[model samples]
Target: MTSSTPRRDTLRFITCGSVDDGKSTLIGRLLHDAGAVPDDQVAALRDAEGRLDFSLLVDGLLAEREQGITIDVAYRYFSTPRRQFIVADTPGHEQYTRNMATGASTADAAVVLVDARKGVLTQTRRHSHIVSLLGVRHVVLAVTKMDMVAWSQDAFDAIAADYLAFAEAAGLPAPTVIPVSGVTGDNLVRRGEAAEWYAGPTLLEVLEGLPPIAETARPFRMAVQGVNRPNLDFRGYTGRINSGVVRVGDAVAVSPSGVRSHVERIVVMGGDLPQARAGQSVTLTFTDEIDVSRGDVLAAADAPLEAADQFEATLIWMAEAEMVSGRVYDLKIGARTVPAQITDIRHRVNVNTQEKLAARSLALNDIGVCHLSLGQDVAFEPYEVERELGAFILIDRLTRATVGAGMIRFALRRAHNIHRQAIKVDRNQRAALKGQKAAVVWLTGLSGSGKSTIANLVEERLTAEGRHAYLIDGDNLRHGLSRDLGFTEADRVENIRRAAEVARMMADAGLIVLVSLISPFRAERQMVRDMMPDDEFLEVFVDAPLAVAEARDVKGLYAKARRGEIANFTGVSSPYEPPAEPDLHLRTNQMSPDEAAEAVIARLRAARRLTASPPFEQPPLT
Candidate 1:
């Protein structure tokens, strides 16, 4: 323990699958083959008799023992002369997906087991998708129970090909697939006669040959995990160096405050060191008196670091509730936790086919592209460059539960772009000048059914009353702001998304904004609501029967849609789901336009949205 140099040859791997996928048995076989298990444990397993008592080796939990399945991620430490190993046996059930994510979060590689008879199931594809999403670069597709299929090469090859195709379609990096029989112990530790036709290294041989991570080539970055104060004279910042190398007297910058400092000393727990590299947990002392604290990261000055309040990222939704935009959560990155919200859902990736789908909200176990706005600027690197600093987890603010995992793709605002702009009036000042608070009035209705007309009328009235109002008319916006957009379900969703976000910015500037378009989807409207505050969101359902809307079709869009010239056009080729409940619903066919406006204005006043409206004067009874 006192040696100046500590042994640094540990391989962290995780075994993941759905329950009854034989994860425990595979782990037991590996431990037994590697000679890592104690002699007593081996003897017990051999003497236990009946039904392959392999569970006795690692299933220490009483629930696991009785239930005959792993309930939690079990960690087992073992070592061979060449390398040390830490294996995490993760649960395979759908309900335990979070547990599997936890177990595989920090692993350098993952071993995904598939039952030979079951071939590739939904869970198999799910686990593969998860492994890739979690940034596990190396994957070993271990096809278990080959003996059940008589060690048939064709069976193994077919499964392998299917999995490979699926994985490719899912955008997962290519994985190495190997067939093995855990029960008979063939091709686990050594090559066996049962797999004579199989021409690959045994599992142990492949594992042993896995190259260790190249820690030195990366950029220097160490997130301050905690402060160490052994004594008054020994105050130091302790953290694991996530990437690159740090040496004494090396110049480093502390982000996101961007404080420049030099390393005074590097202190390992056992001894003082002149240098420290990635993966080493050491305490660093800065020469200058700087405000360095937990969550701050030290990085090389040449490359510096990326710190941003907004970022574009890829997220894998793990929660049961769909990922709604603007919902605040605690983002845990490295050793830091910061408030964050999903500003937008760019698109969702189909895990099975790797196709990008326009998604309003990400469902459970869905992976998607999202724009995240952090409460404060945070230091991050792209996952491709630095896994430790680039990856983060989203925790529900109230429940303190981890809901999603993410990887930063690019910083929205970098350090160089942090300079203050030269503007006379800022956003707050602009809001104050508008008299009435700015907000988005998202109106949804069928084509030619008075959405645009009402929106334009609302904006005109608000402007005439000295309120700074803007109308992001759906058609007009599509010609400019959303010019590239179309009318498909996805395109429509995207169209509304762009409009809502722009409306939010304008509203933040104290304008009363109105969006008038035929946004016929309920989900799309809900997405807009999520992007704004409850009071700020005003959903007006312009209720008109399809017959009326088509009758008044000045653009002949309804006729075109009926003629199959357009696909997914609401109320003609596509289905239009009416709002079950809305903040304001107006039957345009029965009421005059002025009466409808007055009704909406009355509701807004009741909600305290209008500034100068007299105390709820009843309109003259007609």
Candidate 2:
């Protein structure tokens, strides 16, 4: 007399595969059979033979419809009698890694499609690995277009075997496999008389019976998004609990600070709460007046979060611009944003082959293991242990674009081992001893722009006035300081980093450091500027036209660059990002080297950096 009732829980899943693997078709077909698609839409989607074009239901973008390929992530909400579904039809193209990542970031489960004829592919492996990284709890291998292969059981078995092996190696859970044909509507929502050898539940049956995503039981943790001080009467910390549970009177501690506190009230919009769990946003009032601020994490008192400034992580490069080591980027983990740099790309991962390859830089869609160095200590756990505290995004500092996404593997041991040594003497002391303010004069411009000439003149003038100024020429740096560096954009970034560090060190030693380099990128120069004190680093733009600089190239560097001999030559091949607002701009072609040097000295005097130096006499132009 009793009949089984179907579960009604919603499942968020993504459909991803290599291009033309029938990802869109499979989704559309599923929706159509489930009776989720409107009759009008289905009628409009019919092809010449009166057969429904199942791919049209999800590929809603104009470009996607024109090209018949899913360009963007198309999210569709549909439900069968068994279960409700939120499906993200992700792109299958190679360059759409960013789009795939965006969709995979939130999905609890993933449906990886494979063409029956094509078998397992490179991108199939890549998407599988990414979804695994994003913590997709469940996976289903959808072998689409089974009708194309005449519903062959051997072909389905072979593809399943290949993918399962790869999944094991790539640290993914074994996926549920299903053979389904979009055209025939076989083995998708119902079992058609196509493959009697296959004896498994339909795709819909497996999905309906699947268990809910379970979060691992861990110590309570929440990154404080802000302190809610509505008025003078009440003050509470506000954030979503990243993991574990929190209750009133629960013993808690602030991380990286180790400050102890107890929860007084779990405040929500409805009023006081006795308890709160992970993923719930609430305002937590502390028993004590704890010195808690944004970017700080609250955790269980007994099990505080691990604090580190260096970590080895798996990075997925999502930007068009290649990822270069030693270039600083903003690492946004939870509510915390810190200046972080990929110190070294340990190795690039071959997603398809699962091989480790040597790599200095990672291009778009390249996955690599990188050593990250942060500006300050941050609270975190390994990504395997917890997703919320470990996953982060790399932001390009200048553009503020999210360039990469990474997951913390673990903290580097040496990060805790090395501490800043306490010194008796400091920068101010050294500057006072020298009786002049320490500074870095960074001269940026195109090559053959008389930067070295201007630097030499300025240094000579400063030294004559008893100012201990040091000149760091670009050519001279390559021979020693940056000998290992080349002219690639990544290399150029590192080169400027080394030069700026050396200049800072010299400046700290009470020397007026004059650094003359064709620092092409404005972002790199900005990085150098941020390393110094306010107004202490003077950006001097040595201006010169491309034709003038090329004509003035005595070493034949520009000619070689133009003739396809020398690579990454500034003003010839490589781009030069001139400073938008320079402390001083000198037209090298308009002024003699002496005049340019005098102008710099004048600017420094005006800024009070040349307090001890007298006015320099400019030599007459020949």
Candidate 3:
């Protein structure tokens, strides 16, 4: 052992492989042999075979043992004289790949297991690729059940070579491959004579001999978690140092704003510290009273964090709902939460073949390269530069559940170049001249649901009353703006996107824009809502049952869709996700188009978008 190098107390690692690969047995043997298990637990270790039946795993995980599945991640603890270790036992099934990523996110190393009979399976490649993506520094490949193969070195060497090649292509570090029998406890804690041909170190020796992380190599970076102001005199910023170190008098800067200051004091719980390194949560007081907020980042002055509003990232879709391009989701990056959208999906990776395949969206457990546009500029770095600053989780606005994970590769080259040009006459000024609050009245529902008729009536009434107004129908847009797009999922998303943009432009020109379209997905409508400010966008759902709409197929489109002539027709082959809480709900089934138009007019008046009354104070339509 290299005693000169400082050792860390715990090595957080994980055991991951295909199902029935002896991951549980390997961990059980290691824990028992390392003297981490209690005598009482050992008494109940074996099954009817008088052998270690590690078929049962971590506590609270026995409920799944009957099914021989690990649905969630289970953390197990063990120790040796050299160092203590925390091992995450992760599920290996394909559906639970997200759970595996959860365990590997914080792990320093991964013990990738492979059954001697199965060699390297798809799960092996996927787990290893995720490990590489998550920045796990080390890997120890344990080929378990060596007794099944009679401890053949040739089989081990062949499997090792294949895995090494795959890992190299997948951007993973070369792993240490060892042959071991989890059932017989061979070559786990000590070397047995089974594989005399193998002259390398045993499984435990490799892990014990591996060097602990002893580098504070990156520039200092700490995202301000909160502004600490207990009393009047003490106003310090509290956060954990993500990298490097900071001491008193050290020059530092705030990100996204180039405000520089010097560290006056570093205070911990007990007292002030001379200096604080990575992993230390300390309260820092600066010499100058600088502008700081919850989402701000404090960093070394010479190496301040970069800020960007657009980025290129790799996304791992975890939610069952497929990822939709042009949809707005909340992306939490370190201390900051920003409204983010996947502007484009460049491609998705085939984990087994390591091939890049063209894709419009990412499904559950699918990995894709995507472009993200944030609502505002944020301090961040590439994943290779710093994990804490580069990694982010995507949250659904409605459900508030984590839907996806992303690693920032780099900011888009054009993100820094393209800046918003200022216009002297802005939206508010234009709206003031028109004497109305310019807004987009979006009408959404099934096809042939009277959306277009209501929108037309509303447009005529507004224009007749001397208010400048515009109507953008989805079918009319196909004539030019979205002519090239088709009826596929991606095409529909683009169609809606184009209509929303046109509505936004018309609203900017001081016109009340009325949009009539069957923007199928709720996410697509939400994207439009995000594009405009509050009170400037009104979602008017022309509610109608699918059967009612199909019966009233004025354009015969629904009849064609039912005949299987149209592949992705919404309400037939494709799905239409209705708005859960629309700003104005007009049930077309009970009300005529005239009444629906009147209701929309009333809503517009109530919302103050239109200060003028209708053409002649029109009576209720009969």
The best-first sequence of candidates by TM-score reads 3, 2, 1
**Which portions of model 1 miss their true places by more than 4 Å?**
1-8, 43-51, 171-173, 228-235, 413-622
Top-TM-score candidate index: 3
Q: Is 1 or 2 the stronger prediction by lDDT?
A: 2
RMSD of each: 7.9, 3.6, 3.1
Off by over 4 Å in 2: 1-10, 38-50, 78-84, 559-565, 611-622
Better of 2 and 3 by TM-score: 3
Model 1 vs truth, CA RMSD: 7.9
Per-residue CA lDDT of model 3 for 527-594, tens digit only, reads 89988989889999998999999999999999998899889998999998989999999999999889
Which ten-residue region of model 3 has the weakest summed lDDT? 613-622
Angstrom error at residue 438, model 3? 1.6
lDDT of 2 by residue, 145-212 (tens): 89999989999999999999999998887899999987778888888688999889888888777886
Clashing pairs in 1: 17-92, 18-92, 19-92, 438-511
The list of candidate 3 runs beyond 4 A from truth reads: 1-8, 48-50, 55-59, 612-622
What is the model-wide C-alpha lDDT for candidate 1? 0.80
Ranking by lDDT: 2, 3, 1
C-alpha positional error of residue 34 in candidate 3 after TM-score superposition, expressed in Å: 0.8
Question: What is the per-residue lDDT of model 1 for residues 87-141, given as tens digits with 9 covering 90 to 100?
Answer: 8998888777777878877888888888888888877777788788777878888
